[model samples]
Target chain A: MAAGEGHRLHRLGLVVNMVGGLRNLIFPLIAIAFGTSTLDFGYLLLVGIAILFIGFTLFFSWLAWTRFRYIIGVEEIRIESGILNRNARSIPFERIQDVSIEQKLIPRLLGLGEVKFETGGGEGDEGTLAYVSTEEGERLRELVRDRKEGAVATPAPEIANNDDGTADIRRFEPEAEPLFAMDTQRIFTFGLFEFSLVIFAVLFGVAQQFEFILPFNLYDIGAWIGIVEDSGIDIDAISWGARIFGAMAALASLIAIGIATGLLRTFLREYGFRLDRTPKGFRRRRGLTTLTDVVMPAHRVQAAIVQTGFFRRRWGWHALKFVSLAQDSKEEGSHVVAPFAQRPEIDPIMKEAAITPETLDIGFRRLDWRWWFDQWALLLPFALLPIVGLLIFTDVGARAALILLLPVIAALFVWLSWRHCKKALDENQLYFREGWWSPKLTIAPQVKIQSIEISQGPIARLRGLAEMEFGIAGGALSIGGIPVGEANAIRQRLLDEIVKVDFADVNRG
Target chain B: MTDCAGFTPTAPLAIEEMDVNYKGFGAINCLVSAIQQRHISNMDEATETEELTRLHPDHVKVTRIVASLFMLVLIIPAIIAETAAYLNQESGPPNGVFIIPVLLIAAFFVLFMPWRRYIHRGFHMSADRIRIVRGYLFRSDTIVPFGRIQHIDVDQGPIQRRYDLATLTVHTAGNHNSTVSLPGLLHEDAIAMREEIRAHIKRDAI
Candidate 1:
């Protein structure tokens, strides 16, 4: 736990790396198991090859572990890695936006965690110290935070040593009231709303990948029918009512599987979800198996997005997210501060981020009426082409006319979206409300806008309307169908406000 | 159709004298009308003065050369395909039948389109910001404040160098529309613009 010295990762990381390498060979191992029956020369050769592969994996893991080292200097953290091709990356303390500690299932059992330093450069974590002791990770995070703030790198008082060398680190004491926390019942309800069919896709993939190991062909419907018939069911002579009931039962089970998958995934990801406001930043800790502790400073928040589905909105549930330069995960561009909350509950968290929620009395401007008409005009022809082709070329001529219903539905959707899409510019913030079914509200501060653009296509020019786009670091703020004059006025106003403030006072990303 | 000369007896007059008298008047009238029309259009242009500076005149030639090069890439393949089809067929249109239309279209694109593009592309500079206006059918006007510029780049290609032209690009922190490039500026102007923006960026650096 000394600064200005090189340190290696926990020794147990070699075991984790070896296990990870072996997991990649699982399919081939399974193939070998099924291919060989007798202990002949072929079996011996296969076994030898497998042993060699495992040996190589272990040797490489050990080599990598020995080669990797990190040094915490006064102004920067330098990481040296690679076996043959050496790479040394030094990240200045001021450039590091935040530090997060994550513990996967294996590492957690080994009392190790991965510390990631996010620089908000959009590429990814600038540096990561994998498989460090939990206490070491916490100490490193505190040291980086202190150095980033231009404070002396003093040891954090919270991480005290015990007489016996066992970690009794009090990670959470709940000194102040948490901004948001989800109980089991709330998570379950959220899981219900998140009903997913991804489990079916995963199961299908597994079945496809290992179909040869199955007793019968997985995709052959005749084989399944034979099995059913062999079990004393007369499929050919079954009544229509019984067939309908069987189909209903199958549908019900499919729904049940989907719901169960959603619940399982939600429980694994959102168990013990808590968000607390620390003096330094907002601390978010969650996950049942892979625990992640992230602290994002409030000033780095570029915008706030309040999202809800049609059903969730009806039931009064919304999710709050902060659009920061540091991403929460690979796929999520924003950090989810409140996974499930009501309006009143979300207001406090939004206030902490200095983003105001849409008020009832605030006037919102609707887009031009032509927005819907233009879309319908462009889409209706493509829709009619297929229907007309079916009507002319097929025997079901009159019935094909029923296909016109699709275009009707599309037109309705465009109309509804045009109705729902609205934008409001207040004295301090720009609010955009979009999506008809799943409404999302994005609130961005006026001064955070980096640039402005007003664009016009041929049609937009004819209509004397323009699309206005605002440039922010992390989030998107754009609205179309404003009159040309209004767009210019808005751009001038925003530019005036942007130039008035000295950027030295502002936080860049 | 009957000959019109037989029907002109009702309005016979001194055509040569009228033509001689009206020629001078018509020239003066056209000159006056052109000046009046130009004045009206100038008044209209003054109100919407978004594009303060146009791209260099030589950019039209550069664009034409580039477009012709691109057209040749496509034209060569098209000529080969048409020749192959003509030779493989027992009886069909002539060898140049398909290629003629392609050549005509390519000629239109290579000869005329660059001028349209040159007329549409322009940029305006203020003390605090730069506005770029581009595209003919799909016009876009982008304004980047100097205070927000993260960096500035002045780039020139071989052809651009021959024409003494360069492109100036300014990068901002935003993801969308982060880098706005204004091509076809005089090389000296582009470098001057980059230096000016760089100074502003340094002044505003945190």
Candidate 2:
């Protein structure tokens, strides 16, 4: 298996990973050397264990380099390797779920890439293949993908034609070049907002930490503020002056940080972002350093989430991620059609991916406003505390605390509901729109739903609300908390749809 | 009480014995009540029966309730009391030890008999599909077609080992809750049912 540029790149990765592990272990060892306690020593020991494991891995990897042999067969892909413990794995063409090709900076430089095969593992385990040359990975991906499609072709096309006569069947075809590529201009535009926020936060945090460095010292400002005529100087004015200067300095620093961070993240994430419509589904590739290629099976996509923020919405910029059968360790895993795309950019991908609002039966039974009202019940009492306390004390400190607490409480209440008060469903696919600061939209296929539950609490009952739980098969795809009426309607609808449909005829029905 | 035995499928099939309705305990009623408490309201009050049917189809729910009640009334109290006593730190008259044992034995007549009489039922498969209608408190009727069967698996466990019994798991594709595990069947009976379902699938395929 270790033959060509891909082999050299894999070896380099092994070396880099080993060094990284060692560096992390050295930090704790250094701390222990500086008179840290037994707990610290224990931590260091754990780190050493990891380092040792990695070391042993390097040794075994070398052994495998000699023993390994993989045959990308016509109907099956087989990997045979191991020194002391020999093992061989062979997966037939029909069972292959997805085949992907990826290339990172090193792989790009070396003209090599990695290929991964996803199989129908239940929940925890998926399939993977780590390293291959770019050309080899592409070749393997094409062969496996084509074989799987060819196996299922006769039935799928016939079913598709029966279901929707006008079905625009798109076959899986590998592209020589990427479907979408991020230009320098687009990257810069994407960076602006991120860069600004990062810069602002860093500046504000630094200013808060070393606030004493300001020209107007708190004590000096207080002395200047002679509030009681004979008591003290006008410190309030002095403090205000200092605060203004600090704010200006912070703002300037924020701008610089924002730009740099924004550029870096944008450049790295969408360096060569691509989304291609394949026969079975969509294949996505992005990244500069550690490139990732995700080939998603349309049948496995339980949900499609489109997210946009206030700024993003205004600019028509959004991101879409597909919720599929990925394991817990890969919870954030999704087939991203594009990173930071505008509405127009996302349109073609959505259409090609066969994710449309009309075809997908999304339930819109929103959680009643009462859901938000219940939160205020808990919120109002906690918020009233400082105000009640202030009424008794009437002191300056008490007054300020009371004054500050109101807006803070109000903000908390707003943010809490703003983020959590979600709209979700159990459709032919489950679709949801959630999140406050960084809002997201998600859609999932129904067959992937692990379980369905209907629940109602006393408070919710009084308000005529109920919650439905739809457990997606893979990790983190499961979403809950649709309204009572909506939950039931969705449940009923899903039962009507999912229960009666012949799974073998899923493509048709 | 409703039992699966009483269930008469609309189609033609063998009926070795039918248990259509559960007799006394209102197991479905209790479950429905419990389920009702967790949600704000039933999605459709008019179709509470339908919802129950969807939640757990009639035949399967009845068999489960009947079998579970037997365990609940006869076995659970003993297990619970013994477990509580074993787990309890103190020896006392009203605490885990004393209360639990009394509760276990008392449960046999007090809770067991009544519940056993109230709940417990089974279903019979007819031509076309299976019909299961059994519930004590909240009545439910479920009908499933044989053609809808995506896959089927037979399972045997240690407990079933003692009784020389097994369970049949039926799955329908696209339905998360497609599995209907039919238990409390004799080993031979289960094999026959498996063959029946297999034949049904084969017949429907064309």
Model 1, A1-509: lDDT tens per residue?
Answer: 24435999999987777777778888987788677756567678678878898899989878888878887876567676777544445555555657899999888988989899865443353578888999999999889877755632343754566889755545455467788999999999999998899988998999999998988999899999999999998898999999999999999998998899889999999999999987557899999999989888787787899999999999999999998755545555679999889999999899988788879777888988785687688888988998888888889968777898998888888888999999888888888999989999999887777778877676665566678898877767889887766677777777888876534235532
Q: For residues B1-206, write the lDDT of model 1, one tens digit per residue.
A: 11111111111121222245445446544553443343233222112333257788788778888889889987998889888889888996866866888898887788657755665566778877898877656767788887766545555666777898877866665666777888888888986886676555444443
For candidate 2, give the DockQ: 0.07
TM-score, cand. 1 vs. native? 0.69
| TM, every model | 0.69, 0.51
Model 1: residues with Cα > 4 Å off, grouped in runs = A1-174, A212-220, A327-331, A502-504, B1-51, B77-95
For each candidate, what is the lDDT?
0.74, 0.53
Residues A1-509, model 2: lDDT tens digits: 34531222245445544554566677656765554445646667666666676778677666666555666655555555556443334444544556766666655666656666654334322234555666667777778767755655445342265355655543343455545667778777777756546555677688778878865543454544444345654444568778799789998776776678888888887776777655655677777898987777666555566877767777888877665555223646555666688767776666555566423344344445556667566677766786667766776664466465675666675656545545544345556666666667666555444445454455655555545555443434323334445544555466555544333333321
